[model samples]
Target: MAPPAPARRPYHHGDLRRAILTAALDVVAADGPGAISLRDLARRAGVSHAAPAHHFKDRAGLLTAIAAEGYSLLADALAEVPAGTPDSLRELGVQYVRFALAHPAHFEVMHRPELLHRDDLEFVAARSLAWHRLRRGVESRAAAGRGPDLEQAVLAAWSLAHGYATLRLSGNIPGEGDPAEAFRALARLTFGEPGD
Candidate 1:
């Protein structure tokens, strides 16, 4: 008879939550959000089948946490651009697309509210922070009379950048040049010269 496999260790209490989230992201990156399950995350993290449930009660909870984290990271990325510079909007667009490219799994989950706890407080706050950052960039341009209509400018900038990022993520935008460069070119064409 063959020997039985060794037992797996319980997840360490200090790192279990992070481990599960990381495992979930890996699974999402590999097979999309629909494939995620608490048991599978626990298995990937080498924890008890119930471990993920302790941190996230269900799949929606887990996805909500991921979306919150994604929005927070996006806010931080946009904050890196100087707030009122002429190039800020262009740079912000590039960063937005870069963030999507860097975190495709999170990006996919972040926009799909039906798969997450969209009413969750943390998720709502994080999403607002990210939206505020993008809106602030557009508002600054409007303040300078570069774009006369604040709401329209915000919509245009956001729609263009988000559309570009989504297209790139879906493998519809092809090129060997850097994605950021492509965004910059498109931004120039759509918004006119960077410092105009």
Candidate 2:
């Protein structure tokens, strides 16, 4: 057999944290979250195995960062929904599904709280912001007399969007049309139009 390949030099740079996180996301996208390990991430980043520990500490910590970033991105997407409009709810739901589709790896780690350090300050704050944004969108409709029950409407909208996203990501959705249009049609069908 040929001689063993030499190991890569340990990465030393100003943005190792971002590099490691990007590598982790790539790994998760390619092999699912269960395959992620700090050592593996370090290897992918061409860093010493111990380098990841400096930023993430452990698997949970790394996952938590991914989840936190997902929530932050989700919050930004939902923020585009105009407040106090009945159709804003549907818009928010569409944005939610779109965000999931665009960031499948982040979406996967985000909803699996058990895979992350849920109590991390940044993670908690980001999660709270995303949750509050969703709630506010639902509440806007209720306030405008579009929905009868705030809690029920919130649950229904969330379930509908999340279910669609999950199904789409899992390849359970069937059709030739654009997935975004399919999502919009499903939202209208299930929720009975934006204002209704």
Candidate 3:
């Protein structure tokens, strides 16, 4: 009888979990989150087909991880902008647009709740952090005697930034030069000069 084929070795390497996540992000960037498969991620990462499952459990788990990571990144970006001023609020909107453009895969997956475990603790916490970061500017504006309704201010800012980014990402904004500049002009038009 032929000798049994050599047993397949388990994947062992530097940060297999990160590798799988990165590969999945690339697929997400190219073909949207719905196109990703754990098997495909394994192939892209040069591991056995079962290897990705060891880390992510399933597709939803992988997406929840991505969403959580994305929100944390977004919160960090927002935090980098100076706070507690009208100009800072405008800057936050610009930063929001920048993050979406820079991390299209993460941006895409972060908003699609149907594809993730929305109640996952890490995901919820990250999302809440990002929301609070976004809300900070609105609260600051209210504090500065603008007297804007807190909920409305937050929703307006979010809607503006999110809508602009979604339009640009969908190619609906033709020949948009410099997303930051475009956003700044739109913000100025909508809300007047930052300090107004």
Candidate 4:
């Protein structure tokens, strides 16, 4: 009879899977998705070429994992800042940018629909939750008497934040002043806050 399957040896230090993911993220941040390769990631991770494949079946799987993690993280960030009225949506918008800046690797895959597992229940749940939070925040702002049309207000808020994040990530916006502050200004304009 064949021996029983061996138990997983507890890894005391750096886990190979996480190390590969870390290296993969570094690659994505430095060169974007098109430039990332499994062998390169494995080499950078200091693991066998097969190691990454063990964790992620292929490039798509790796990217999907990154997207899932990004969604989960964004959801957490949205949850961190309370869904208050007026400035809450604005604050969440800034936090969204912050999340991308902080996790550029994750950000690289988060919004790429092609790379993500949109049909997967877990991915769908995470994405939906983050969006729901944003929508709820918009509703709260409207409740606080700070809007015109609900759909318009939410769409405007989404566009401002999403566009700002995309621009910042793509280097379309040069460094001079604060990106968040710029985003806040846009949010105010979009929300029609005060005399604009």
Instruction: Give per-candidate clash totals.
Output: 0, 0, 0, 0
Off by over 4 Å in 3: 1-11
CA lDDT of each candidate?
A: 0.89, 0.88, 0.90, 0.78
Residue 71, candidate 3: alpha-carbon lDDT: 99
Q: What is candidate 4's lDDT per residue for 130-160, written digit by digit as tens?
A: 8887787788877767676889888877878
RMSD of each: 4.4, 5.6, 3.5, 5.4
Q: Specify the poorest-scoring 10-residue window by lDDT in model 1.
A: 10-19
Clashing pairs in 1: none
Identify the runs in model 1 with alpha carbons over 4 angstroms from their true place: 1-13
lDDT of 4 at 193: 61
Better of 1 and 4 by TM-score: 1
Cα lDDT tens digits for candidate 2, 86-165: 67878888899999999999999998988988789999999999989888978887887777699998899899999999
Runs of candidate 4 with Cα error greater than 4 angstroms are 1-14, 194-196
In TM-score terms, candidate 2 sits at 0.90
* lDDT (Cα, tens digit) per residue for candidate 1, span 66-150: 9999999999999999898888888899889999999998899998999998889999999999999998888888888888588
lDDT, model 4: 0.78
TM-score of each: 0.91, 0.90, 0.91, 0.82
lDDT of 1: 0.89
